[model samples]
Target chain A: MKWTKRQRQPKLKEHIKEDPFVTDEALAALFEVSVQTIRLDRLEMNIPEVRERIKDVAQKQYDPVKALPEEEIIGEIVDLELDKYAISIMDIKKEHVFSRNSIARGHHIFAQANSLAVAVINDQLALTAHADISFKRQVSEGERVIAKAKVLEIGTLRTKVKIESFVEQSLVFEGMFSMFREEKKIKEE
Target chain B: MKWTKRQRQPKLKEHIKEDPFVTDEALAALFEVSVQTIRLDRLEMNIPEVRERIKDVAQKQYDPVKALPEEEIIGEIVDLELDKYAISIMDIKKEHVFSRNSIARGHHIFAQANSLAVAVINDQLALTAHADISFKRQVSEGERVIAKAKVLEIGTLRTKVKIESFVEQSLVFEGMFSMFREEKKIKEE
Candidate 1:
């Protein structure tokens, strides 16, 4: 089936969304277009390269801010749904390690989890009231940590969030955060 | 009161203990010795210089390890009394800051507090079960953070610890940790 440029672009976005890890070559074959055409469409559509696509998919998935400003979040939140779930990714670099050893510091790991816990709450203001956490293993420099925060329970004044961080498939850190949130106000008619 | 060299050395140690921040010149004046003699006495006693003395005072205040190995603590613990209180110090260097901005990352601060919280537990095995923490201010490169942990309550299987971090006199971070600890065992007669 021959497809015009206008028709293919929207489909390309949808195709990539369904599988963010899909390679450009595979996308070109599926779209029945030249590789160059696929590349141009992606560029015009402002889609990032495939590697970044894995981490960037969350950018468009949901509204990022409710409890705190986006800039205040420790990691780039790749996916979010307030008072439900959220995901963020952080790259460990030279600056995040101890000079004597290249292992990423533990607090860096905690900050990512703690911030994600705060970000997933559905209130205008959320403060962490308590947390229980463990370091499962050490993460080294050059590793990327993906932290997922899931809301366990919600109440008028508090929410419980469970956060687990992984380097690839390995669990590097885990925590449970009890967050204090301002009560949701009733809207005027 | 003419004190012999042997008598004066013990007194010097006592004086320094009373005030770890005492100047070498003050020690000389108090001990009725020349400044060079005071320096020699301090060196012979293996005392660190005054600048380091303030941060190092905790080294002699308590037994350092109960829950975890001393080396595993994120900051250099200078004071500790397991299940009671502890203090640690960390110097923020280039390696601990963001490359783009010199502000120390939030996790570094959290790690210091978390580790201190764990260190203060009076058990052979202690794990952080939960924490509620907040970063009060941004810490910059070259700043030194002092973290103090105090035990709030003790339970047969769980303990609560409160931790606070300061850069000099300014509060930088604070946290409350609920820790899980192995229960004490009774010795067989």
Candidate 2:
């Protein structure tokens, strides 16, 4: 029995399982094939596309509980959906405080909040489309940081969420994010 | 004259010239010294601290440019100012565009936009405090990206900037960044 490239493709899935975030180019290089060929293999293997993979990895890595290692919570989610939106509040850590220096790295905090916002959405998959953020105060590394998010609007194709991250009752970061929810289709009889 | 360990220390300016973006850990490892020792050297050299260094490097590396080879742009800006910022549209040939999987990696666009937003600020140094970004459309590998930025608000110690990145006329990404601009003080007579 002769094995064709198609017959050998399932093995790629195993490699992907080992590193789901690996790129098609890497796979192509490894298999001595073109990137388009590797992509075809990936599509056949039911692997999510690169964009999907990124959101998935970000969702896992930026899990609020994991991202905020030294912080404690103060508020609970009043509302959330499975479509990749969530909201929560926690005390800021002294070590997490912001100086001119720390604020410069503010994306960490925004990423965390945005990740949680996406996590609570009702869809099985969601990705950020856009965001507007306003920072009101400097937060200390160890100060208590309060976070809150709400679905401002949900459309048939898109969803908009608002998130607020605060420290010591002062608003440190306020954000509005537009998210794209991958809707599941129903087969019509 | 014999060179002692103290004399062997790279001149701060020369070290920065070698690679302004070199991490303290990398510098330490290269110089056969501890991270703390490298930091002290940086301090004595009037270089910003580690976090500051990261912010500076990240900002300068992320800015937008009118036109130039991506590599040349990246190379020209090396170590210009510890806190210098600039932005250039990411072309297809640049390494980070692919290495970071930006075309497929959803957040790389945001990362690049965020980095450029921080980089274009005028403070002798600035860092991203927080940013909210929206990805309007998926940018492809060969697309021409435009990163536009302007100061939204400038506080006594902190400044906010709004950055909108577009691919042609389409708004591909938009972000609002809060940065801590180091204010140089003028001594009173």
Candidate 3:
């Protein structure tokens, strides 16, 4: 019996959602497909394998706001093509365990969201002129957190962006960021 | 010449501003005293050194909202303990560097400030339901960032807090946070 492309895709999606964190070998066994096929499917679905997903999440969380060093960034794209304007992150590595007595530290998450928001603007240089954030939940190491940013309003001089961060699919931090584009120098001035 | 108790104590007030972040070495050298003496003076003045201050800042910036893990906090209490509900923090360390992209990964700063706002509430547990933040300037590592949180309004189920985070004696992030509080457990029918 031949499996239709439409049928196979839905089946793969269902399999992945059921076990969002699963190994390629396990998936290959369950689907009766080669590891290469499983990998190809995952790529098509924008879903990396468990280990790769974890690494992607961690690396994205820890990715710096800029590659260059300056007193401040006028406007630098950190997560280009993602259109995500802000970021939030956990400081400890995934190997660490959660402890009630241990605080995850707040600035790490806020900085992540804010930097992403700053990076999303269209300009050669943009600087953070103002920011505000609220922490909703405690985040621990190994927990998956994602930052979501939206453009609220954009103007010639300033653009406003809203950012929210979630850990384990729960909202943990929220913020609004504003960016100022550097003015161009006139040739005659 | 006899020196009075007031005269013997250094005029720390003159040298350090309210919510100031100073290094032990810097303080010691400035006063022409031993590091031990500076430490003792810091204790008396309720001022914390860079490391301790950073920890205090991180706690306010990074930790979860509903519960606080016990840890020794540094930084002098600069504002009046308002009866209406408020908390303030100063001098966030490496985390600040990340938020302003003064370093990298800047979202942590917003996370810290928002967490502190939630932690300062009088309720047993407070969860941030929504927030808006504005970034005013870039904050670097080792710079003092002060967070001031104030309750804007309170209702039966929700409370709103306004927070402002400052670095290098300048306003950097300002935010409004809305929180959900569970005052009593729901009874099952």
Candidate 4:
């Protein structure tokens, strides 16, 4: 419970690794140190902020995706709690639009939601079995689409996710996806 | 009906307008003229070939899509038979790729299938109720994806469409879409 700075730093690093989403304040309490000490320790260890840590964990944790590869996800997953909820962000760029109109292609929007649906499942193999989707409005280039997916139902072989994408305050797309998983078991953590 | 060149040209225009997908061979047989004559008539009247006509019709028709607008469909619909089948062609250009990898985005592919699924329905208002999809292979830029959608089942409120997309002979993507329509009524042509 009490250790010198030299001894605490290694344990702190391991703690953060085990729970990357752990906050500095939580780490301070766990390690019996000031929050400022945790921050200083993190700085010395080259650990990033909680937000960056979440992104890094999201990027590195999926082994790509439990369903596929990590690079296959359409957006940068900023927050993910597998089989519970996930949030991702995609900035519509020039490449994402129609050259003639500059309107963001609908698939880009769907992919973001679809991939999130897949990523949120706590399974080694997750695939979309069905999706009920709607394009609520047109998304143009230069907009940042923040997509949030929530697990609506979980079954032995299936899980359902509801994903809503927004460009700021306006809802741009919505989808409900039924996902197929290999089997029902607690994932090894 | 038999008619002079002057008479036939106007009739040909009318016929094409009536059925944009009508083949030259069919037109020749209907008009009792050689295929060459029909071609010549089309040439003189400034009407393009059937392939071009189909593209034009696919583009100009849909108002742009019965559910939304013409511009909403992801790819250019090359051939369509409302409620039966439809096809679209998308040449993956530079704009469709991630600048880092040049792989065509997943949404672009989905949009093509999703839009075709919407376009094939013979309803004034159709929306995707559900879709089961898979990415069979990674598609790169410069490849032309030919997507074909066929109606699998028709219900009073929902219709099922199976869409397969190919890069040459290799299957790149596939999806089964369950689409919802306003009601069971034949679209007035």
Candidate 5:
């Protein structure tokens, strides 16, 4: 619905707060306003552009988490449920492997899997006690590795986590991880 | 030996080329000149600051080796020899690990190893066929991981590489990588 500028300005601020990465162009279409109007509204609200907003969030929100710091997770956590399941995505880059092979080095795949595994643990301190891991297939450079980690068992001092990393539908790596949870508090989500 | 203004200018240029990360203070100390003079010399030579030089080099030298670009390698390549050995150093930061644990994400440590492994391969097409890997200890954030990769065996189509990652001489992770050399060229070293 086409809303008045007075009404649209307030809505714009709220939308940006909800998703900082929301584009001005998209907001223009959503609010039925010109791009200039949206930019003006953002300037009036003292809100930076989408790129700056992301950088601001990265700097501010990359704080300590329940299990670890936000930034140290191999890939950004797109979804999470503590002690249950978690997912992360990493864009394989040229730096991730040998220039000759163009395939992602094994550990890059492992990093994505391992971090997602640790993040799913509900604790302040989660350390890898042991892991039975293997590379199932070769992952090429530039392929995105989507790692999904599931909690298999939650014991007194240890948790069994299973991680399977894939490029699209193809599985690249899998691991059965034993995580040691130190100082576990009885918290439920 | 201390060099004068006339002699120092050329040497300063050479030093920056050798190590773009060289500090202005270090250059000043080496040439027995003020920091301002170093800046002036840099300005006169049309060279940017250390940070800018690094960015420039990253942009230029990070060529697509095979699958990934050179710049994406986790740490600076302090030393390298194709199909032989490679050494890299990574400074752990809050950005690289879980905040609460302060331990680096496994992949980061793995990245240091994997990148070094790829780097040590002589072929222009080096791919990790398989890796038997293990983590020996937890590496906390703010520690440096020195990854050293050595070629265990070089075959006609594959090279067996061994990567050991350490923090202050204490082993953290070890892996035996079987890298596939898809196309081997008889290039002189």
Candidate 6:
């Protein structure tokens, strides 16, 4: 996405609009300009620096766990140690449950756990190869669901992560995820 | 579309997939039949009740702003003070705007306001009691809509808040929300 300065500042804003975690250095490289020029352009345009942009995105209500801002992470990560462990919390509102039963849907619990497992990987480019998940118990609205993820093993091209979710210390869901982390070019070799 | 019970069966399936929020009463009225007749018609067609249909739809999509559990909320909140005030910002995307007109959907604005009103309540058990809302102007995708909410009054069981949304300096939406809060209590004893 190369752009002349005349065209780049606004385009720079749009790129960040789509992914606020993008660094100025990456923007500079993409625009084929010096990093300082990207910084200056962002400053002139009143866009915050990358870190601040991420923080601003984080501070929003229902702001999600955003390791990959484009990935649909359904919860908020309060703690993460890349590829080692991560934890997130999702509060179930009335909308999260079946109106007739008031029981939270199973997939929401899976999404929270699966998303955390994927988000905890160290690689910049990673994808979920497959996930094994179980719904141990029904969760209800007004409950804060906490999901914890631990990287069990890291292979050359695959990483293993386990996620467990609890509400008030009782297990409600569990998932094991195998993630793909190798680059496509490297895999071709 | 006009249809007898036999003709409505398959069409009912399609309508609920598109708008699961449609109630039995509404469907009955639309189909010019008694509510019980609608129930029998639904049973004959093997369609679940409205609540189940909604849950099914929610599980398959990136649904949020979840009044109906089929629409997505596009913002993050920078500030919130339960039962008093709140602030959030939504970056409109291509999907948020109409392709032909480039105007964001009216329901998205309403969702942002209604959800904020419910979210800002101090109680763990709160819902949108009612909302009196209006769109002040059409907003385009790529615009950041900043919504600020203020509590107008607080009653024993209900709180009233006003929300005004803006893109730049222009007002795009205004809403007065009445929210309900209560204890599950006559039983917490």
Quote the TM-score that chain A achieves in each candidate: 0.71, 0.48, 0.55, 0.64, 0.63, 0.61
Q: Each candidate's chain B TM-score?
A: 0.71, 0.47, 0.57, 0.64, 0.61, 0.57
> If both were scored by TM-score, which would come out higher, candidate 1 or candidate 2?
1
* Residue B51 Cα positional deviation in candidate 3, in Å, after optimal superposition: 11
Per-residue C-alpha lDDT of model 5 across residues B1-189, encoded as one tens digit per residue: 777767888888988888666667677877788899999999988989865675665565433334245676778766666666776778788877755556676777777777777777655556566666777898887676778888889876567889888776578988888776656534321
The lDDT of model 6 is 0.67
CA displacement after TM-score superposition, residue A92 of candidate 1 (Å): 1.1
Q: Candidate 1, fnat value?
A: 0.41
Assess the local accuracy of residue A104 in candidate 1 as a C-alpha lDDT between 0 and 100.
72
DockQ per candidate: 0.22, 0.18, 0.35, 0.21, 0.22, 0.02
Candidate 6: give the clashing pairs.
A60-B76, A60-B77, A61-B77, B83-B120
- Residue A82 in candidate 3, Cα distance off native in Å: 8.1
Off by over 4 Å in 3: A1-10, A13-79, A82-98, A101-109, A122-125, A130-143, A146-154, A162-176, A183-189, B1-66, B72-88, B92-95, B98-108, B166-172, B184-189
Could you give candidate 5's per-residue lDDT for residues A22-83 as a string of tens digits? 66777887888898989998898899986577567655533233677667677777667788
lDDT (10s digit) by residue, model 3, range B1-189: 433436535566455554355556566665677788767766787776655665565555443333443331223233423314444455556534533345423454565565666566665555566666666666656566567778878776577778777664568778777766556222211
Residue runs of model 1 more than 4 Å from their true location after superposition: A1-51, A184-189, B1-85, B89-109, B115-146, B149-189
Write one digit per residue (lDDT tens) for candidate 3, span A65-177.
34223234322222343234443333344323224434344544555565566565655456666665667777766455567677778766667788777654568777677
What is the fnat value (0 to 1) for candidate 4?
0.37
Sort order, lDDT high to low = 4, 1, 5, 6, 3, 2
Query: Where in model 2 is the C-alpha error above 4 Å?
Result: A1-85, A88-104, A184-189, B1-85, B88-108, B124-132, B139-171, B176-189
Better of 1 and 2 by lDDT: 1
Q: Summing lDDT over every window of 10 consecutive residues in candidate 2 chain A, give the lowest-scoring window.
A: A65-74
- Model 4, span A1-189: residue lDDT tens: 599999999999998898665677678878888999999999998999776887786666443345546676888887778778888889899987755557676677888998898788877666565666776777888777889999999976568899999875678888888776665644311
Across B1-189, the per-residue lDDT of candidate 6 in tens digits comes to 667767878777787767665678777877787899889988988889865664565356421332222132335555666556776667788875545457675546655665566556666554554455555667888777878888889776567889899875678888776665554232343
**Residue-level error in angstroms, candidate 5, position B47:** 28
Native A-B contact fraction in model 6: 0.00
Cα distance off (Å), candidate 2, residue A111: 0.2
